[model samples]
Target chain A: METKDIYREIINEHNLHPSHHGEISNPTYEMDGVNPSCGDKIKLQFKVDDSGIIEDAVFSGSGCAVSQASCDIMLDLVIGKSREESERITEAFMRMIKGEASDEELEILEEAEALADIAHMPARVKCAVLGWRTMEKIFKENRQ
Target chain B: MTNIFKNDFEILHDDKYIYFDNAATTQRPKQVINAVSEFYRTINSNPLRGLYKWSVKSTAAYENARSKVAEFIGAEDSSEIIFTRNSTESINLIAHSWGLSNIKEGDNITVTILEHHSNLLPWQMVSRVTGASLTFIECSSDGEISDEEILNKIPSNTKLVSAAEISNVLGVRLPIEKISKRAHEVGAVMVVDGAQSAPHKPVDVKALGADFFVFSGHKVMAPMGIGVLYGKLSLLESMPPFLLGGEMIESVSRYDAVFAPVPEKFEAGTVNAAGAVGLAAAIDYVENIGFDIISQREEKLCRLMIEGIKTIPFTKYFGSRIPETHSGIVTFNIEGCHPHDVSSILDTENICIRAGQHCAQPLHEHLGIPASARASMYFYNDESEVERFLEALKKVRSWLGYGN
Candidate 1:
């Protein structure tokens, strides 16, 4: 419940030096993630090859620490995985943040486990979920 | 002895409820609360419906509240006072009933950029239906409002000009009286959103010379579900009823029915009479304290709040830095923190301030910022609360891991 617990040292580090914090050279798919109430907006771009392996991923936008850090950590996890595996990881992260991830799922959630504490923050759930939601949209759109 | 005013409201005694969101809605006093309870307990009958004793007494209570509101706002006739749910509803009644009926193609509906969405959106609807284009008056960066914006924006094609007496977001008072004069000179009706002004200062709609004036009862120490809209007698007569139902009719039939006059015509269905009565009690409480004292106390508190924010090096004020221009509101943002983050940290300290755009997107867009944090005060708040708020605000950047 303490405010300090919510904004950990790691979140600050990730926010300051966000991974893939710029646009992709030529993204196969990209989409916008917006939380209008909080004014957090993000544009997610990814380069997935014909084999469905995500070759590159980058995110660019403005938001609070939780949101920026969430997207950065997320891009770092999903970049080398196949689009199929990326979708699975996105699912587990969503489940983890909602306090529903099993032990096996948390093990796969990777560095995103640092943010599982976001489950306790009711107001911040949206910030933690923005990047994962964006990833889900990209994969869903590609399936079509 | 100076803190005696805090005793009127039970909520102020609780050490945790550091309520600084007075601009959104104010905390009700015990007297206002008891008046509402007494109405439900003793005189719980529909007004203007039956000739039974309870009904007559209820009608008397309701009508008396109307007169109190009329007197409170300095309306010449009680009939000018029409009750609605809140300021939003009151303004909507004006737009739907008056704007729809009167506005025509090629006419212009003038409004300011700083209007709350309640004040801004209705005009947009009216303009859309009538083919009347909207002309927005701009405010200076320091939130200095002048009649020049109106005088320049309002052409001879303008039919009506609506503006807020004080902006809920910027916390700066607008020059409504000067704008009213200009609007009149240009043959336009002036509408004032007095939601922010009435609660902080003594409001005289007639003196302001606005055609339609509105303020919510809840923001002035009354309960919710009640608001006052004071329209010029002639203007109300010209517009049709916004809502049509039983009480607003003179005589009903299976076919066509004759409508009642003016205020009642607009106030359809069973009225919020209990809310009106509670509003009257609130007015009595405000009058007892007097506007002169209320303004002076709030002015001092606002100045202290502005000073405290200034002391924090990274804090950036959104409106006028001069405290005298503020309507007991201080909207600001931290250099390295988003407003939501700032307010979230402050909330952990039990300090309640409004974050986000404060429902004025046009104004926020004009200011070139997505959102800001607001700490609005009322007479119930004091210097100690300001100190507590400043202490919490100072920690926001640090809590978000920004360096001291």
Candidate 2:
């Protein structure tokens, strides 16, 4: 896709009804994330069953459109997956976001392929990964 | 294009480079460079330690530079000026030496929300080390703090009032004279961080009524790694040396050691002779141009830039819009675009500017913004450069799909 198309898609997704937005009811786990360089913040929450599978995930916060959309997109990827499977997905997603994925791995991130254009713009990379980092922190803390 | 500083420095670009990142550091004049080269080529010897001819000449040159610095800032005695690595080290010396000795439990050290991290973090660490508490005086929406507000914040436990004369991020010109007087009324010593003010305008420590004044030489058009810390003679005498080594000692024995007096005691190691000479040359260059002319020129440039930025529909300026309240900086954010993105786009044009927190994160938090783009002017920036910057900013806004 063209750079403008990718940017337009991100901007549209940001302004339209974003997925995984709003608070989760009676969340079992929650974590706060902040981008210190810019003061952007997000609070992510999740519900996990006794089998360590994520039943649901939601987030609420204020930030740049890219950050909001990135989080919304990330929430759609991890719901109903086991905690171990979610970690593997997050690692694969990060590699794709950083433009370090193999061709076969690139096929896995279908709708998320638009984020590949963000790698050329260094400043927006943080915006592209804001939600993913927050989710990573949550799972890392859950294990501990 | 109109020449700001007589084209003394080459532009190497069109319509003059918008050299607005003055708070980070300044471009050196030809005179400062020549002075440094002359020092290295001719009198290359350490000061005060040797009695040879070259050593005596070098020592005299260094002392003369010290005297020039003292006179430039209206210091009562040149012996009260101590050279350090930069403003960070100068403030650190004060925090360690004076704070370690004077502050006790329950004492309060008041600073403001507009301070650079260099001024704020040192006091924060000092307050943590000692049992003292750190209090911050609130700033107005426009980034100005009233003298009355500062006075009101000085409780009975307040021991010091540390403030910046001009904020690096906001460009707010604080009323140092009034604030210093109020601090003195409360029996608290006032310290002024002159890193931003000293480069743009005249600085008279005595007139400001500050107990201590600190500034970096590089910010004032000299080379890096050299700065000045000026304190009152009595205050200097009371505080112990921060670092101990060869040059700062008066006499040493196996059992006992005597320290040198005031400023010499603080300057514990070999000094930056070339850097000091370059600073003195910078002072001479500024004096020759006349500070009143420089101040007027920079003020006019700032006004022009502010007016230009106001025309951009999506741009929201962060600090005081009143001309008198702001100095040479214009910080603002373009709607719908992050500051880092704005900075990257501007960089493609070789238009240097500072983005992100500008080392005043708390101020950004208070302003309810994540980051801001700052364009700070100097005496050398011309009006044509301001025009070019505005045109480029409009282009950037359109490119980001924010401009109609």
lDDT of 2 by residue, A76-98 (tens): 77788888877776787789878
Give candidate 1 regions above 4 Å deviation: A88-121
Candidate 2 vs. true structure, TM-score = 0.88
lDDT string, candidate 1, A20-133, tens digits: 799867789989999876778899998888898889989998887788888998988988889888888988998898899999999998788888877877877898899899
Fnat for candidate 2 (0 to 1): 0.24
Candidate 1: deviation at residue B322, Å? 1.5
Candidate 2 overall lDDT versus native: 0.82
- The models' CA-based lDDT, in order, is 0.88, 0.82
Kindly list the per-residue Cα lDDT of model 1 for residues B1-404, writing each as its tens digit: 25777898888888776999999999998999999999999989999999899999999999999999999999999999999999999999999988988899989999999999999899999998999999998999887876667779988888899999999987788888888888898899999999999998888887898899999999998999999899999889888888888799899888988889988988899999999999999999999999888888888998999888888989978788788678888899998687877877788888888888788888888988877889998888888889988888888777777678
